[model samples]
Target: MTTPLEGLATIVGPGNMLTDPTDMAPYLIEERGLYRSSAQAVVRPGSTAEVAAVVQICAEAKIAMVPQGGRTGLCGGAVPAGLDRAIVIATERMDRIRVLDPVDFTMTVEAGCVLASLQAAADEAGCLFPLSLAAEGSCRIGGNIATNAGGTNVLRYGSTRDLVLGLEIVLPDGRVWNGLKSLRKDNTGYALNQLFIGSEGTLGIVTAAVLKLYPRPTERQTALIGLPDSQAALTLLGQARRASGDAVTACELMSRLALDLAVRHIPGLRDPLGTPSPWVLLLELSSSRPGGLREALESVLSQALEDGTAQDAVLAESGTQRQALWRLRESIPEAQKHEGGSIKHDISVSTSRVPELIERASAAVADALPGARPVAFGHIGDGNIHFNVSQPEGADKNAFLDEWPRLNRVVHDIVMGMGGSISAEHGIGRLKAAELARIKPDLDIELMRRIKTAFDPDGLMNPGAVLIP
Candidate 1:
């Protein structure tokens, strides 16, 4: 008499199946404390075949399945929810770079390979894999593709969706769809691979991907510019892009409050500018063709400074200085944690309307939640601003957090009005499922539901994710 658990264990090997509460604890937890759920067991599948086998048994047994990757996802997409007796298909053991075709400029990697390891592999092969984010160290490639992650490099290289040439997905029915071809153009029908990229595992589990790589950057320039506002940041971004022949890699906008929070909390970080400014722009440019990048960047900054578009600027003269400037931009989120109960809204409008979005959102937050510190910052070049609102000084943390839903309504209303996405980079996990349903038109919601039902007829694949049941 073989139990379903015993069958899954047999498929992945007994050592890979974790049923002990202590061993399964980490897998059951969500990145944000917002979601927490239990699983029958966590099965570490080591290959696409193994993943398929596990899914088959679970499907036959009518056990719900949750596909979990690195578990570094901020949204609860990877977390098991809305079901009891569900089995967690963990991908960590499946990590292996299947192929590194530097000549072809594509790397076929398993879904479980850590993002940083892939970057290093690409760099060693004399190429660049530019899908970078703060969680690159621990986040896995599978989850990145699953979320269609947009990171710092999206300004230039585009999102994970753009970097992916192909994907191999485990369909909801325990079948493996091997679409891992490296070809740049294959108009062979519905583009099935793309359907799973940003589906957040509701459609299928991403098993592996053929990732696009670029020529390694030979020259780079990093600078921190003190700007009067986000509008100035946008102006400087356009000028720098034109001057550098669109070599601009990252254009991050940080508010005074966001930077101040970083400087105040994170040690050894100070404002790089000589004078205090209301906003700061962290601009970076990288190119395969070496030598003239700095001069081009300097020329743009020179003009901006002369015209008063930029108040003041500090260009990183060395690698160490570059790290320092980046540290300021990257550390803002961590610093916000020190300040109590920060509500984050990862929203985006058109690049041209970012300033107006910030202004309108800030005003809305102020009116809705008086004394809330709206830390507006992020990739202004791509129009994704992380409009995070910190709690009022001395306000109760839990109470302020209780206001998250209210504040979301306030901020998201304005964003929707301006034709912006409520969840830009972060997909519609459990966090925004209801909100998505609320705002999305009935027809749009119907289509999404149709897709979910068509793929996951049993509602077994990552239930209660992107589409609410």
Candidate 2:
């Protein structure tokens, strides 16, 4: 007698399917290590047709399926939830760049293509694919689209949802929906590609995508400015945008604590400013045209300082220095892990209200757990902040982690009060599903459920992910 997964193996070929637990370990673990997934096997389908065949086998058996891409998501969206049997449909074997049309300014790529590779392909074509993130080298385009990922560049270029033109998805009942059109102005009917873009794999599996491209920036300027506080940082962002003619490509914020942790943990990474302030803004300006970017950025900083919005600043004179400055910004998460356990919130508010959200949330967390250090940092230009709290010195890791729920509520309530989103950039995977239900309007959630039902009536696509059953 053979197992049900053995049928799936026949479709993907024996070499592409893994039944041994050791062989499947990598696919079964979430990036944060907060959740461990249990699956009957991990299937690697090589193409859209192969993916459809595998889905058909699983659907016939009524076995749940989780669509995985690179598995670098912080939300645990790709990890299987329950003890019930399931299989992970890994897209690694489907990695390919199917089309690159510089004339149309678009690239059609398989879902498993790594983000960094896609950017490189666009660069080679004298274009730019601007959806960047810390996990670009490991995260796949499919996952980025699934979560509607936003990064530093979101202030200018927008999120993955904005970058995508169309997508190819395998439906719940093994039907393939190829909506991969590269046209920019298609208004024929309902924009169906969007339905799966941020659905977190609950609706269907994204197999490929047609992504929009942009003219590559030829001139660039980066600066690190020290601010009195988050309020000052917000003000400086306005100044930078106005002074630079709205050419600011990135504006990231970091608390003094966040900077200190990065400096201590990451070697060769040092604070560019001689003296530290309560908050710092890592601002970058870019243009396709050459010259004057440095001068424009300098003028912005001069005005910010003269107006008392900035206390001190350091403009990167060389590419090496600019990279060093970015390293300090990107290394905060790894640094926090080294310090102790951390409770994190990826929340976003209106740009004007960021200061209040940070100030009140920090005070609230500190009052609840004395000595808890808040490391607030991220894309301030777009109002998404990675507000994280490190454990107090000498506290038990597990004990500190157990306070995740209480701490989350303290932060989320303040976010909701400010008309902000609790899960910004990161999708509401299993972690935030309950919080989403509690906070979201009943009618809004009901509409979402109806859409989910229409797409996946059997609910086999990534069960127990974004929606609670």
Candidate 3:
């Protein structure tokens, strides 16, 4: 008779079992510092088979198990908070590209493969794996699929859900569901593979996936535009898309406060425009067929300027300029960190109502906290705004942070009234689980509970997560 710890160690090998507090430090914490959890051990499994074996042992011992990816999630989805009687099943060791079929436009990759690495692999194969985000350099593919991640590219390529052709998941009770098929069309009976795609590791642990790939873009046009307001962004997006034959891949909206913080705090970053505007939009168009993209972009941009759709614009002449423009958009969250305590909201309304959402939320938060600065920015292309509130100048960070709950209600009430999502791109990890339970309809909660029960009867699989314990 072997103990559960011994059993796990035997399956993954002793070295892969991190039992020491020092060795397990990295795995026990969440990315946003919201959760500092305790895990009995951290086991790294190099393959799907090893993961399966580890799960089986945990199930037999009645031990709770948390399936972890790169831990890049801001929400506490990967954090096993309050589940101290658990072990973290880290997938970092299971990284391997099983297959890359350029002809079929698909790649079979293990869960631990870093997203940027996969993107580079696709690029090397003369294809595009466009599920890119700021954290692509370190975030693993498994977490992306698990959260159904939406990034700057989602305006064009869609989210992680769209990019996945199929998934291979390890069930709660140690069963492996091998649905890793590369086919684009599979009218199979239940579409069970879709179950775990955005399940956030609650239903099951994702071990591998068949990811969709697109043709590599031969030409790209990047432009940062000054906008009069959020409504103007909507108008410009529609006009640009229609004029450019729907080549708009990304359109990010940034508020003045957001751009100002980025330019001021982020070293070596300067505002590209001569005159400042209330809002800025980073619009990018990419096409595999070259030669006409720039002309079309320029033509529409010129028309936009004349028609008052755009106030001012700066088109990237080189890769360096393109990168500089992106740094401004990407650095907003980091810049907010420097300003002190910040409360974040990853909310989304319909694409048409983005301006309303921004306006209402901004006003609501300001009235709630008069001096608080609103930093509104994100994928305006898809209606998802990272509505974050930076503390008033020289404010005590922790004291300001204490108002998170109150400010959340102020903004969330506005979002809910607009028929928008409280957690848009970021999945409802442990952090938002209670709010999700409170605001969602009873029937919606019931259906999700039933699904959770069907998949994880014992509640040992990531309990206290999306469907909180």
Clashes of each: 0, 0, 0
Q: Which parts of model 3 are misplaced by more than 4 Å? A: none
- Runs of candidate 2 exceeding 4 Å displacement: 1-3
> What TM-score do all the candidates reach, one by one?
0.99, 0.98, 0.99
Kindly list the per-residue Cα lDDT of model 1 for residues 119-229, writing each as its tens digit.
999999999999988889999999999999999999999999899998898888889988989998898789888888889998999999999999999989999999887
Compared with the true structure, all predictions reach lDDT values of: 0.91, 0.91, 0.91
> Model 2: number of clashes?
0
Error of 1 at 200 (Å): 0.6
lDDT tens digits by residue: candidate 2, 3-26: 677778888999999988999999
Name the regions of candidate 1 deviating beyond 4 angstroms.
none
For candidate 2, what is the lDDT?
A: 0.91
Residue 318 in candidate 1, Cα distance off native in Å: 1.3
